[model samples]
Target: MLVSKSAIAAVLALSCLVLVKPQVADAQAQRARGASAAAISYEEKKRQTSDIAVTIVTSGITCTCARFAEDIRDIVNDLRPDGLRVLPVLGVGGLQTLEDVLFLKGIDMGVVDEDNLRLLKKRDPALFANIEQRVHYITRLYNNEFHVVARKEFKTFEDLKGKKVSFNLKNSQTEVTADAIFGMLKIDVERLNYDNNEAMKKLREGEIAAMIVVSGAPQSALSRFRKEDGVHFLALDERSLPNHDLGAVFDNYLRARLTHEQYPALIPEGTSVPTVANRALLVAYNWPESSPRYQRLAKFVESFFDRIYQFHDGSRHPKWKEINLAADVPGWNRFKPAADWLARHKGALQSRDGRTLADLRPAFDQFVANYTASTGKKALSPRETEKLFIDFTKFLESQVTSQSTR
Candidate 1:
C-alpha cells in the first residue's frame, strides 16, 4: 500500500486518538462515581440534621429585637424535649432572607415576612405548606409616622416637593416603606442616607427639608421633636398617602386613624400623623416528627396565645389587644407548625379531616364583631377583656384551620 504524505499524517493522528480514548473514558467514569457518592453523602447528611434545628433572624439592634427575643424564649421553652436549639442567624438583611432559607434544605425552621409568602411559595410549594399552616400571626407591629419636623414651614406634603429628605438607610425597609407611603402624594422624595441622629441634625441645620423616622408608638423621637423643635405633623389622606397596599401586605395591621394629639409636641392638639400599620410575624417552617421539642413548642404557642395579653398589656400601646392570633389575614399560612396545632385542636378535632372556609364564616364573623366590641377603650373591663381575648384566640385557631382545609 503506497500512501501519500497526507495519508501517513492521518494514520498517525488516528493512532494517537485511539491511545488517548481509554484515559478519557477512565477519567469520566471516575468523575461519575465521585458525583454519585457525593450526592448520596449530601442526602444522608440532610436526613440526619432534618429533625432538630430552630433558627431565628431579626432586624438587629432595632426596637423589635427586644420583644421578639422575649417572645421566642417562651416559645423555645415550650418546645423542649425535642432537643431543639434556638440560635440567632445574622445577615438575613430583610424579607429576602426568608426566600433564601426556603431554598436551603434540612434547616427545619426560621422566620419570614408574611407579605413575602406568595413570592416564597412560587419558589417551592413543598417548602411552605399553606398560607395558614406554615405561618402564625404573632402580633400587630406599627410603623410610627415620622414627619419631616421642620421649624414651621414644612407643614404640608406638597410643600416638601423638590426638597431633600433624610432617610434611615438607602435600602432599609424603612426607606422602601416610606417611598411607597410618600409616593402616593406625588412627592418627589430625595432620600439622603443618614443615621437617625444625623438625620435629626440635618433637619435642625436646615440642610434637609425633613426626615422620615419610624418606630412603634411612645417613641422617644416623637417626644424630642415635639419638645424641642415644635414640629408640625404632616397629614396624609388615604388618597394622598403612599403604600395603599400596606393594608394587604401586613396581616396584623388595621386601617386605623392617627390623630395629632397622640404626640403633643409633634402635632398640636389637632395634628394628625396619618400612616399605615406594619406587622411583624413569628415565622417558621414545618416541625419534624422526630423532634419532641418542636411538638412541645407548638403546645406553648397555643397556650401563649391564650395568655399573651398578660405580657403586652398596659406597658406600651393599648393597641396590642387588637392583635389576634385567629384572624384570617393574607399570607399567614406559611407557619405550618402553629397552623397545624391551631387547626388540629380547634377544627379538625371535631371532625375527620378539617373544616373548610364555608364551614367557618358564620363563626368567623361573630369573632370579628366580638373582637371589635372588646378592643375599644370603652368596650370591656380589664377582666372581661382578658377573657374575651382568650375566646378570640380559640376561635382564630378554628377559623384558620377551617380556611386551610379548603
Candidate 2:
C-alpha cells in the first residue's frame, strides 16, 4: 500500500501484461486451428491430383485409334494451370476396347469400332440391353478401311474361296468384320487367325491366299509391308463380290478408298483401292450432369473441340483431317455434354455434311477453274474472282447458319 510512483507504475504494467498474455495465446491457438483445417488430407490430395486426369483406352499401337490417342496425349495433356490431362491406355484392338469401356475401372473413354457395338448386340442382346444408356459417343472419329491383302495371282476376293486366308487375331476388329462380311457374301474360306506380321509372312510364302486387316488406311503394320513381295490390297469393289451385291456389307460399313498417298507401296500412283470401311468411335460413359465426372468430361469436350482445328494443320495426325466434328454417329447416342456442346456450336468447324470449308476450298477452286476453261475463259476476271471469293465465304456461312438453325 505504501508504494512509490515507480512501484505503482511497475505494478500497473504487470497487471496489463497479465491481462494481454491470454489474448496472445488465444490468437496463436486460433491461427493453429485455422492452419490445421487448411491442410489437405491425403485422400483429398489424391482426388485433386486424379480429378483432372482422364484415361482413354484404345487399340494396339499399330492401330489408328492408338495413333489418335497419342495425338490427344500430345495436344490435350500438358496444358498448364487449368487444362485437362489425357492419358492414353493401349489395349487389345477391335471390340475388346469396348469391353474395357464398359467393364474396366478408371477407364474414362475408349476408341472402338462402331461395328463392335453392333456385333455385341447381335451376339448377346440381353447382356447389352442397356448398353446404349450406359455408353455414349463423343464423335465418329474416322473410318478404318477393311483391307484384303493377297498375292498378285488372287485378283478377286472370290478367287480366295476355299483357300487359306488369315483374319488377323481372333476377336480382333479385323476378324470380327471379316467374319461378318465373308459370311454375308456367302464366300467360304479356310479361316485362319494370325496377327498382321505373321499373316503377311504366310501370305508371302503363299501359305495363305489372303490376309484381312481392318484398320485405317496406311495402317502402320501394312505401310511398311512390301508390295515387291508380290502382295497387294485386293479391290473390295461391289463388282468383285459374288452377285455384285454389297448392299448387305453397306449395312454397317461405309464405302471408302485406300488412296495411293496413304500407302504408296500398296497402291499405285493416281489410283485408289476401293474398300469398305468401319467407323471408329470415341466413346465415353453416360455420367450424370450433377456428378463431378460429368463436369470433367464436359471440360474435355470444350477443350478438344476448341483445339480440334489445329490437328488438321499438319502437326498432329493425318487422320485428323478426316474428322468431321458435326458428323452424326448412327445407333449411338452422343454424350450429353458433347451433344450440348455441338448444339451450342453447331457447324463450329464443318460446312457441308461434316466437310469443313478448308476441306472443300481446293475442290471448289478446281471446279471454278474447270468451268471457266470449258466456257473459253482463260482466267477469272477481277469481278469474277471477287464474286467467287464472296460466294465461297457465303457458302460456308450459309452452311453454318443452316446447321445452327436445325
Candidate 3:
C-alpha cells in the first residue's frame, strides 16, 4: 500500500483517540458503581447499628398497641438524614423475657409496658442498668377499665362470689388489676387459670360464671365475646372495694367507665360501670449518645410530637390531652427526653396545655443570635437551623451517662 507520513500519523491519532475514549468510559462506570456501592454501604452500616434499631414486641393486636407500632414504623421508614429502622415483633410468653433476649442479642431498643419494665429493673438492677438508659417509656398507651362480665343472673360483683372467675393472663396488668377489683368489692371468686380466648369459650359453655377482661374499647376481647355470649358487664361499685391501692402495683389505676361509647353491646350507650383502667407505657432501652439510632429516633420523636394531634383524636379520652410526660408521671424517668424537649420547645409541642412547636421558636431565635455572635456568620437557613438544633440536642444526650428508671 502507498502510505504517506501524514496518513500514518492520522491513523496513530485515531487509534489513540479510540483507546482514550474507552478508558474514560471505564472510569465513569467505575465511579458510578463506586458511588452506588457507597450509598448502599452507608445504609447497610446504618441498619447494622443496633443502637438505632427498635423492635416492638406485643402479643395483642389491639388498636392501641398496633397504632403505636405504626408510629414507630413510620419514623423508621421516613427518609431522614438519621437512619432508623423499626422492627415490630409480636411475641407470646412475657415482656421481660423478650427484653432480656433482645438486649443479649444486641438489639438497641425494645418497646414494652411500664410494669414489665419496672419488673425487669427490680429483678436485676445491674442487667437492667446495662439497658436501662436505652429503655424509657415514651408515652402512655390506651387505658380502659377492667370489665367483669358475668351471667345476667348475677346482679352484682358480690353476687358472683365463690364462682369460677377467669382472668386474661397470669402476672399481666389485667390479672393484677382483677385481684384488686375482687378484693375491693369483697368478691371472693376462685382464681381460675384461663386465657382471654379460653375464658370466652368457658363463659359460653357455662363452665365459668364470670370472666374479667382488661382492654381498650371498640376492639377488646371481652367486648367482642360478650356480644356472642349475651353476658352482662357488671358494674363495680367503686365505694365497695377496700384497700383501693391494689397492692401498690396498680397505684395509678383510675375508676374508669366501661362505657357504651366504646362497647355498644357490653356497655350500652351511657351505661357507666366502675372499673380500673391502667395505661400501657411504650418503652425502649436507652442508647448511648454515640449510637446512630438514638440520634435519628430523637428527631423522629420530636417530629411525632410536632404533629401529635393530627393522628390522634383528642376526643378519645380526656387523658389523651393530658398525656404530657411531666404531668402524667412527674417523676417518671421514662419521658425525660420528651419532657426536656417539651420544656425547651414549650409552645411548639402539641398538647391540651396550649403548647406547640412554636414554643421552641424563641429558643431557636436566641440560638441564631448566639451562633451569629460566636461565629461571625449570618443566620442559618431554616433547614440549617433545624439540623444544628438536632445536632446540639444529640450532643447533650450523649453527655448523659446514667440509666433512667421510673
lDDT of 2: 0.77
| Best of the two (1, 2) by lDDT | 2
Candidate 3 CA-lDDT value: 0.56
Model 1, C-alpha of 367: deviation from truth (Å)? 27
Which candidate number maximizes lDDT?
2
Off-target runs (Cα >4 Å) in candidate 3 are 1-52, 74-76, 79-83, 92-134, 183-186, 226-228, 239-252, 313-322, 350-406
Could you estimate the TM-score for every candidate? Answer: 0.55, 0.75, 0.63
C-alpha positional error of residue 242 in candidate 2 after TM-score superposition, expressed in Å: 5.6
Local lDDT at 302 for model 3: 68
Error of 3 at 92 (Å): 4.4
Prediction-by-prediction clash tally: 17, 0, 18
Question: What's the CA error at residue 39 for candidate 1, in Å?
Answer: 39
Candidate 2 per-residue C-alpha lDDT over 164-203 given as tens digits, one digit per residue, 9 for 90 to 100 = 9999887788888999889877889999998878888898
Q: Which stretches of candidate 2 lie over 4 Å from their true place?
A: 1-45, 79-82, 242-244, 347-406
Off by over 4 Å in 1: 1-56, 60-65, 71-151, 238-254, 259-262, 287-300, 316-319, 344-406
Say which prediction, candidate 1 or candidate 3, comes out ahead on lDDT. 3
Go through the candidates in order and give each one's C-alpha lDDT.
0.50, 0.77, 0.56
Error of 3 at 361 (Å): 17
